[model samples]
Target chain A: MSIKITNGNATDEVAPQFSAERMVEVQRIINQYPEGKHKSALMRILHMAEEDFGGWLSVPTMNYVAGILNIQPIEVYEVATFYTMFNIEKPGKVVLEVCRTGPCMLVGSDNIIDHLKLQLGVEVGGTSADGMFTLKTAECLGACGYGPMLQCGKHYHEHLTTEKVDALLDAFRKEHSTSSNN
Target chain B: MGRKLLLEHVNVPGIETYEVYRKNGGYRSVEKALKTMSPQNVVEEVQASGLRGRGGAGFPTGMKWSFLAKPEGVPRYLLCNADESEPGTFKDRYLMEKIPHLLVEGMITSSYALGCNQAYIYIRGEYMWVLEIVEKAIAEAYANGWLGKNILGSGYDLDLSIAPGGGAYICGEETALIESLEGKRGNPRIKPPFPAVKGLWGCPTVVNNVETIAAVVPIVNDGGAEYAKIGIGKSTGTKLISACGNLVKPGVYELDLGVSVEEFIYSDEWCGGIANGKKLKACVPGGSSVPILPANLVCKTAEGTDRLMTYESLAEGGFASGSMLGSGGFIVFDEDQCIVRNTWNFARFYAHESCGQCSPCREGTGWMEKVLHRLEYGHGNLRDIDLLAEINKKIEGNTICPLGDAAAWPVAAAIRHFREEFEWHVTNPDEAQKRNFGIASAHVPLV
Candidate 1:
């Protein structure tokens, strides 16, 4: 549950001392907790820093979050590396997770993978030359009804065929280019 | 006798909302619960209802409620375990999405029954949209005086929140779920201090599945005796089933217990039939966790008659014949489906989802996955099948959480029926890969 705690206690606002703007969000986040136990927000701080610093957690960013939270650096490091949801290194601007579990695999997921590689010139876990899309494989995105699916920035693109994959890449380009035009 | 277990009120949508629900006699239970009956009555009503947990364990609902240790003036809790992360189980997710209010109303009525001032719906982090609906429904309940402080002028105060889990399948375990609620790593605590005694901030909590709570609304609405009149002995009330994976008409189906397994597949209301009009090969009858049953056993009785779908009926031959109605997730496989490959895939999923809490599960799951992966990829041998079965036996009742059993059951069931398939995979590795199943290639070497 994401509660809006506006009247949170004023804790020590620790920053990474790397980027000034990202350090501010970390401050407001730390402010939501009471002082002395700032370590409660270590993972949250790391998550925010990673997203703010271009889609992945750098080693220092995890270290910085550990510093801000008054937690063991290894503790933060361990958490940051443990979860598959979190990327340790820099991720592509658009990280696409293709569903590779049973249902998807049964329903022509291989063709979708081949399509992604053919179009993006990248294998699963590799970024395209333009750094626009990084293809990754994930186990069961829970969209079985829409097997052979892909997730682009929290949105599900399900029921993919070779044609659908091609069109999907085009749509990605069109949307990104449109956003760029603005 | 076939009874209506899951699909008692099918002709209605929005069964969660108060108004849409009220038309078909919904919150009347809450009204009756508030006006006349005491909390003990509500508990007794559930005890009479004979509703099972539906979250795989099939523990009796009333019994679980009675287990709460009432020591002095400590606060009790009702945590709705809506984290339906079991493979092939999507029933709870649909229930919450389709009838958020049904669960909310159930929570209100249940909280009143349990004397719980605070309740939480620990939803899976994957279902971000579900959290929105649940939170909104809770807000509406608060606005309508169904939640928070003197609810419906009954002078009972309650607060409800839905906390999202950060993608750990093991977290669905009650103890692990409690740990996750405290914003800690999702890992199971050793029992003895079961959630009933010291759960959720070290207070007594009754963590129930979303379907379990939703059942409360119906159980309270119609008297428990009436609910008991519906299903067979032990397994009372309807059960919501998410029947998928190679079904002709795969979707959510609610039906009464004691209905024959044949009827569930043949009846139009349920699966319709297998894909390509193919003969059924095997089924994970319950969620992904249950042992698989070969088509012959699934379609037969211990005495060779067609098997029924009741709890006892399915368990006629014990582990060999039984497949749990776990999480109400029924995954079917057609004759063309390879049990070895399918078992391998399930093993890989369990390996990935293990929270690394217990040594047996953490290490055992990984090893199991590797062996199954190798087998399915054609590097398997006759001994590999026995080895996998041996490993499952080792990990079976030896873990802190049911996750180990969940991981083991599929392998055990698959080997029980398809030992020959494992032998074939070992003898003809190329043929297994020709099917394009990629458990072998899925091996991303550990750093």
Candidate 2:
């Protein structure tokens, strides 16, 4: 699996730093733990780093987070790879993590997954040719009642249909285009 | 119409807000516990209530609290396990999303009872939106003087914060939750030094489920004996059942424990019967980790008794002829649904989520997933069913955490009850791909 860099063509050599505002947020998170245990802030910081560093963690990004926690880069790498939510490699602008567990499967999530693949012109875990969408299957996302669901960024789109998926894609494409033009 | 303790005011508009929640007798538990009742008194009330852990294990909540070790100058902590990742369970998320303050209030009262000033709600990352909702409620709580220093002038101080986990099902286990809270990989620690003795950052800690803590509000408000009177023997208090899959009404319902399993499935007040008017093929009454029961075994017990929703009732005949009320994740399957495929799906989930800690769970779960996959897709022999049973045995009792047993049970129970279905998959490979083995004709006769 090749890593796709979402930001400027910077490799692992690039050292990413949180903006001044995010630094304040980082300090607040660090303060939530006891003294000398700022390491407790690693997971939240890694989450913030993923968001700020173009939705994936590169080696340098992980190292930067380690530095913020005053821990080793290996510590950040171990955690970032352990959790499924963290994207170790750069994904497309939008990643559709569709739930494919038992309950979701019982409610036709398989059909939803196949439909998403057909619409996106990419197989599971494959990014679109245009680098617009990445389709991935997720375990039960705690939204079993509203099955056939996919999570995009922070929003959960549940009780999905083919039409809703199409509309979502169109809206995402439109949103990206408008934001780029701005 | 039975009873609702946690979600009683759920439908009230703006109940998620502090003012609205307070107006609806929300923080009365906090006031009552802090002012009148001592911490031990609060603990005794919960013990009297007979409330079990709502997260799955169904351990007594008050007993778990009484086990907390208190040494001089060592601060204790209370962590709420909000990581609801079990395949068919979403009740915690529903409870947290709809009534955030119920949990916040429960934390305050529970924290005061535990004599701990600092607590945290370790929520799964997928519920980020719900976390924000809870954080808003926490801020509302702080503003209203229910949280922070010397709350309500009772000379008791407490601080509560929300910690977000980066998506791992094992973290739902208390030890793994503490490890994750300390910013490590969510690997389950071996017991002997349970979290009650040595927990987060080496302090004596108590971890309770979101629903378990939220239920404390009613226990304190109504007294433990009153709370105990609501449900059948042992399995006291109302439970939040998140019903899904092939159900006419697939959503979270506040069920009074001991409701008949048949009524819960067919009554309009509960699941309202199977979807498309189809006959029930099978059901996983609890979360996917529990044993799967066929239609005949679900509504009635092995001895021809009516199956109830209580922990003891649902688990009447042990794993051989019963299932658990685990986390109240009621999953229904209709006639057309395939048991082999659903079992494979669940195995795949456990495999994907195994945390790769203990070899039995880490390796055995994957092995089972592969074998079940081949069986589901119509490329297996009769011996493969026994091989699955073999794998289930190896994984069940040989792990540091229950995740291993959880992964093993459904596959074991599926094969035990539906061996005919597995054999049909092998005997008629091509047909199996085209259609499911609808309801199994060879159900074990009730004793």
Candidate 3:
């Protein structure tokens, strides 16, 4: 993962057309409310950046958010960085966040990890050599009862064993039939 | 793993259905309270149970309920706080998502006791799915004749609503929860009326946490004294602890409150032990809002007393050496993790979540986070660390609510326990980067 950060309130030099378009729409989202409180849309701005920048925000994308919010880049970067849902860098096309915290750990997160390593031939944070998925180990996903869980995109696949992990990966492969260049 | 207690009634064959709950001794409390006992008696029963608010502060639930000024002809509201945003805490989320009806049952019983005709559950916005589950449960409740006009022929009426809140840690504060329910900016307000006197739409209100209210059903059902006998002094009944960070067993464990911290961590019943055979370095007994206790102090206080999990035992010497059992968020740390980096993570959270309500919290959290971030990256002087301490002192009680204090405690405590690690961060930069994230995370799954 590559991330570039700057100190000052930076501008969006290499801006995307859609990001700029959505920033204007987000400005209208701000206009819905009274002046001096546009910061209420801070979450929505970060949300837009997440959608616009391929499911994550770069430091530059956060800077663009700050420029649009008419606040310091630090302000936008701060919110972008805090939330667990908001990612600073792009994971692979199939982002697999396996739960590494307690409950899941108790119920065989280790065996599930070994299976993913053997199947994907990469370490936890490393992407598959083919780049089909980038695996990141995360803190608790909060589904303790359904321990040994793995999240494939937005859905949580819980009570996972080595076999269940394989089945989920196979289903993902079937869903994404073709390979592409990044 | 320790067996489930609070989650026992969640999905047991017929738990969701009212008939099933009644068969299991459910709304018998509401019936007993109305026909057999007065509202004051119900209040007294809860008082006798020695149950404290599960929402971080550990305030007395009965005292909070009685503090309500339920004057004649004025409407009273019971706002059930389900905004479980504390990092290590996921107990309330489980209660709301799995057995939405349990909260519904507790709400009706408590609202009846407080003379409140209406109540609301304010949940975190990220858990939008919880709103649907709870709403459907509320519908079931209304259809079953357990809620709304003359409930069970007891001449009592109760209505419940669900309010979703946007992300802001400070909104966990009761006053801020009320402001969010009113569709405002979700900022903390000055507390003089204290919610009991004036809250939610300017009516007499009682804002209890999801755990606090849920505990009520058990208290009233078992009778107050009986419930009080379950746990230790001042910390009665069972508590749902969300253990996280570097621990071996990290899940929600519902244990009687008197269980010692050692029993909770090492007995193989709760968290089991620390992962990777690593030595325990420190622990934040509560959520990040409380001071972090060093491993030595945690094993035994500065005066060399074994640290137990009860309210009094945990906070024996106060902040100088004691830590609070806040929200029961036991975050374990191993020696390998950089204290400065870990502290930076929390400081950043507080600063972003300050709500900009007061200068002390608003600017103070920001400055401390920035200085800590730079200091952690080897760009700070010894003077910067001193400056961070001074800034925290100003933020500690100078805000409208406890948010200010919440922002400062971890920063101060992190330094108190591991000032050398923080200084090492400034003295050396390259070494900090090589350190892995969250000491327990495996680069690969275990085989």
Candidate 4:
């Protein structure tokens, strides 16, 4: 079975809304498709929603996206659940998705996953107690030649050694700490 | 060095920029096709070039274009499939990241050939960084006269955009890509009226791989015959092979399709041989979906003829002793790597990626993964080996899409080439966990 991560029931909460500038950007994205095909912008808008609304899609958040496209709520929910990229449940601030497929495995991705699990003090799909980091194993991210890699947000950290993992965690922790202080 | 049609200017600084790419003779194909040639004339040139799809299936690109049902007064769409999720393949991502303009140029040129007024590059979501690069290139093209309204005074109007897929490997399939583009689940639609007849938004559509579409830039610029002269027969263009797994140099390399497998594996110019001086145990010459070949059979056919890297040559013996050059994902396995473990890993990937549309693929992939996992983790009887083969036979041809066959072939091939290893895992479960089965005796003589 797939991993499910949810923070209690969020259905009763008010649906999140996009900001004015973000709404303009969403309109531009909808315009990319032909007329009456505003549904085509659903995926891009969901990505924006995920980024802006606490890093995961709550029930109310998906409903808000459905309202934006003027589609059925079921349409939004089915699509949100189908793709693995969207997080239905709340996650830590930083989600480290490491590639654990064939080529990466051959190049010692197993050891990297084990090392991450030990360092984070969590299992494969668990987040740390402080809600700082969540560990996840992903399928191929297409950087096969540069194996033993992980993706934190948009950047890919490749050729991972234990030392590189240590430095990465430290850097992320430092950045978070500095930002929170501000 | 082989001639690089698509990546000739890849090393030039700022090739990713439109200014630098335009300075190095980029967008010439768009000019050539739009300014002079008719749409049918462009198709004829591609047919003459003998260019097969660089995507896994080696179908003739020209033939696929010819099948587009051009109904009067209907808009046709061309989608560039940038969903590069095949396990061992990374060439598409590299090409898009390094020289994004080449794909932009190819998209415009090929769109013109198909008389398409709108196009989209459906890239995988994981490569968000690469998507940003291509989006910038597309914006630059729009800024110039290359895109949007009457190009080169040809009265042809084209508008291009990019679509991002939510993380799903099934989205790489063309139908699934179309579904995803329509903001739906990435379940593949049943085919009969292939995409040629009924596609995106119920209009005729043509979807081509990123590499396949990029090849059109060179095919139109220098004429088809010139492009056809580079590689061997049937495989008449340079191919980008992404070499990974236990290689001295593991990255993307473009080679003439007829280069010998031995030369590619051992040559200083190519992979530079196995990493750390380890002997090669086996190789998945194509992507992870294709059959794996034992070391002795990798460089030579069953008949002992040299195995060249062409589609026909790689598939010399029909899976009994041959494998396809699928997507040119050359994955090498060193002597220390474990086959059972690697096979289970791939099976798990398939299980995770399966869209659950077809029962055989949905259930069979999970079953195969479970059985393989059990065997790899040191708990399986001898019957589980045959059980895997049985499941493989059931899933090979029972699905609406090729994902079923793809999931079946590797398991089938691993057992075919390394049955003894599977048996060893069953009999010596504890020892198997301790050490690999080491390169099973000389190639098990072609059955």
Per residue, candidate 2 scores C-alpha lDDT tens digits across B1-447 of: 567888888999999889899999989999999999999999999999999999999999999999999989999999999999998899999989999999999999999999998999999998989999999999999998989888889889998889899989999999999999999999999997988889999899999999999999999999999999988889888999999999999999998898999999999988899999878889998999999998889999999999999999999899889999999999998877778889999999899999898999999999999998888777888899999999889998999999999999999999888888888788877776654334322222221
- Enumerate residue pairs that collide in model 4: A5-A89
Ranking by lDDT: 4, 2, 1, 3
Tens digit of per-residue lDDT, candidate 3, span B320-398? 7788889887777765555676677778767767778699988999999899878766677788888988998998878
Flag regions of model 3 displaced more than 4 Å.
A1-182, B1-5, B8-20, B435-447
Cα lDDT for residue A14, candidate 1: 36
Q: For candidate 3, what is the TM-score? A: 0.74
**Candidate 3 lDDT over residue span A1-182, tens digit each:** 11121222454576533444664566554543334545545565565566667767887777766655567767666655544556787777688878654334444665687788889989988889776787876554555545677766446787788888888888878777754321
Per-residue accuracy of model 4 over A1-182 as CA lDDT, tens digit each: 11121221335557677888888778778888888787888898888999899889988998788777777889999999999999999999999999999899889888899899999999999999889999999999999999989998889999999899999999999999999999
Q: Candidate 2, which segments miss by more than 4 Å at Cα?
A: A1-13, B435-447
Fnat per predicted structure, each in turn: 0.05, 0.88, 0.01, 0.90
DockQ of each candidate relative to the true complex: 0.25, 0.77, 0.06, 0.79
Worst 10 residues of 4 chain A by lDDT: A1-10
Estimate how well candidate 1 is docked, as a DockQ score: 0.25
Top DockQ prediction, candidate number: 4
Q: If scored against the real structure, what TM-score would every candidate get?
A: 0.87, 0.96, 0.74, 0.96
Selected candidate, larger lDDT, 1 vs 4: 4
lDDT accuracy of residue A112 in candidate 3:
80
